[model samples]
Target: MPELLPQIAEPTDASLAASGRRVVEIEARALEHLATRIDGGGSNRTFSAACQLILASRGRVVATGMGKSGHIARKIAATLASTGTPAFYVHPGEAGHGDLGMITDADVVLALSYSGESDEILTLLPVLKRQGNAVIAMTGRPQSTLARESDVHLDVSVPAEACPLDLAPTSSTTATLAMGDALAVALLEARGFTADDFARSHPAGSLGRRLLLHITDVMHAGDDVPRVGLGATLSEALVEMSRKRLGMTAVVDDEDKLIGLFTDGDLRRTLDDAALDVRTAMIADVMTRGPKTIAADQLAVEAARLMETHKISGLVVVDEAGRAVGALNIHDLLRARVV
Candidate 1:
């Protein structure tokens, strides 16, 4: 049997909510202060110089920190790596245990410490210097040992801690994180890093799908595409739509050029006229002439947008000369996560 749970005392709902709001308010102000510090509140030159150092480095930015600052350092490293700068997080605690071998002369070490005196991180400064690795310090105390010995120092000091006890690394950590983001984005812009460049690093993510997956990558081609000759009957078009399961068919002339589009919606309107026999009715008579078409190389997300804008469920992929070469339906975009 599972052990019985302990009955823990709970704080008042009102009190807990108030505390939550207070924490957010403190953290938000901390971030604001950081912005101010970067602009004119302190010395923005230090931050700019730090960015230049990393930008000029030929190797990865190796980040290390202790405690809560360590967690923030890991995230900062990831952001840098994903946004054009190559970086990795090295735990300061583990650095003394032979993990220091990961450091190379070409690498730049970015160390984080709220007090700027984390012994685990401070002890590595001599080794970093010995290996010719430049140090960039993210710290609340510029006068601290780590800051004084570093190549550049970023002041991430906050007005106060969000913790009621004023002991936990709360506001300072938040400030440090904001500073890290600022550094990464600054470098990204300096390097002309684009969303396409970011997408390449995250190919399996949604942004990558939106940017990298093209219409040709999802559209049906050749015989698999639903298409009908302009001279074909409505019934023949319906047969093509059924066989291809695209809910629509392109109407092409003898030159194999797309002249119009026919779909289930067109069939519904065609059925309204009881005087006409759909089996014998020509497709061009009821087709939508010069319907919206996308290029084979167009982004799948753009195709999805086109469908959304037109209240459409399918699209025909066309060649430069307006010849239909492929077709795709909403289902295809859905499967591709384009919708």
Candidate 2:
């Protein structure tokens, strides 16, 4: 038997590389084309019309689409709902069966399709129209049936697909995504949605914790506060700090206003000096003055910053009049996830 020759791999085709380059070029051109249309004179009218429909919606914005457009629609709906607008995704096929009942006269429908001729989407138009809900169409083809039937048509027309085969929805989907973002952001600004407002809707998110969680909510108050009088003995102050387990004690005046703080570091220094008298020495003599403090109503993250910046383990929480009302440490912030 003749020995089999070793098979060599064929070199990559230059035509395939050229095709890839062409796809990228088309995608870039599509984005540029969409950008130009947005700034064009007549295009503002289209945006204004879409904005009016969304602003006037008394109920949620129902987003529906088919195929790859459906995925983009879902993302658009999520972005809208999280930002400020009340929005949700509904499959067009589901709507034809029973989900059409979810939409009401008070709601607005946002339909997505690249060709603007998706049969699944078209099937619900008459029912939506009968329900008195306004339809806003997002499509690449303005003259397609969906756009023609829409109350407000948003032209997401891209020049071509980024796919080398020109069949896959690449550039068109990207343009559609960008347009949805533009709409959501525009509505977000129009509604004057703030960080606090966003936090209310996203209480479990990190941004919510940073914005909504105040120092007072997590600080140790009442009996947990480690406090000592200005003239209290070092031993007495240490006892209070140990009992509270806050690693520090606030030295307060008669009015309970914080004047100084004594910590483990202060105790260590006092111990280093053999001449220092723990029982006879006053806390006022050894406590560090001008200790860092924070307002109770301030964000817990801010308190964390102060602690980290000053190289301290704790802080005295003060009232509006600067009276020390509570105390918190690094552990408190860590437990609250504010760190």
Candidate 3:
């Protein structure tokens, strides 16, 4: 018998690519399952109970979990806190050691465990119960001890794992995350939370600037505003501009109503004409008419947009009657982070 040639293994189709596609399909199915479960009659009571417990919370919602579930719990807690519902995350393992002190009768506990039987989380149930705190459990198994002990149980079960080995918490984790988001959004709507409220929670973020930053908040007021009265010489307007250090000045009428504006660019253009006398030429003769202006009550982001659209660096903020009340430049918006 001829000796069998040595068999060499070459790569076929990429298992990594196949695995990615499988993961997407599994997550999609898991999300669909979650949607169906939430809409089903059995989940209505649980959702309603959970909402009532959260709505009745006098203190914070303390979210706790272990391992991968812990990460999701932390994110859920953060979302709740930022969206007008006061909440924080506690580690289940640490609760037994010292973190249990953070829980009080006024607070509600939201515990997450895929198996609904994490020892660390289960161990804190009695303490929480004794403290008279309400417990809401998010788990895959409804019959598990954590679920049975909870005041409200939210089912986050999936059909199966995305992992072919069926040992990893893949689809189940996705389902849990989606459920948490749904809860946060529902609470947000029920509370009539507005964008201004959101801005208060995220004062340092871009959305805060867009929603909370008023033009007056970033505008130059009082003497810092470069201004020149009507009939003032172009030379005098330039002097006011230089003294104010704004590179420009508003030309206003006797009543302080803005009539026009003069800038360094106008100065350069006037200089090109030897016949234009700085001392004798009035600002009105060379000033640009109908210059762009913004209201003091307008949003700084809108001011920024006007500046960009007009290709100018500054704007005069006026009152409802069109009298200049303040001034602002690109630098102001930049400093306010409204740009």
**How well does model 2 score by local distance difference test?**
0.90
Work out the TM-score per prediction: 0.88, 0.78, 0.75
Which pairs of residues clash in candidate 2, taking residues 3 or more apart in a chain or in different chains?
Answer: none
In model 3, residue pairs whose N, Cα or C atoms come closer than 3 Å (at least 3 residues apart or on different chains), thus clashing, are: none
Q: After superposing candidate 1, which stretches have Cα over 4 Å from the reference?
A: 1-10, 41-43, 205-212, 270-281
Instruction: For candidate 1, list the clashing residue pairs, or say none.
Output: none
lDDT (10s digit) by residue, model 2, range 104-184? 889999999989999999999999999899999999888999999999888888767787688889999988998899889
Candidate 1 or 3, higher lDDT?
1
Q: Per-residue lDDT for 1-339 in model 1, tens only?
A: 999999987889998999999999999988887886675645458878888899899999999998899999999999999999999999988999999998889999999998888999988999999999999998998899998999998889988899999999889988898899999999999999987798789888778898899999999999998888988888888888889888899999887799999988988988999998877888878999989999998789999899999999988899998888999999999999987
Can you write out model 3's per-residue Cα lDDT over 1-339, one digit (the tens) per residue? 999999976645786688799999988998998887774785377876787789877889999999989999999999999888999999989989998888878999999998999999988998899889999999999999999999989999999999889998889888888888888888899899987798889877778778899888998999899999988988889889999887789999888899998887778898898988777898989999899999988778899999899899889988887788889888888888887
Strongest candidate by TM-score: 1
Model 1: per-residue Cα lDDT at residue 45: 80
**Residue 42 alpha-carbon offset, candidate 2, angstroms:** 5.2
lDDT of 2 at 314: 91
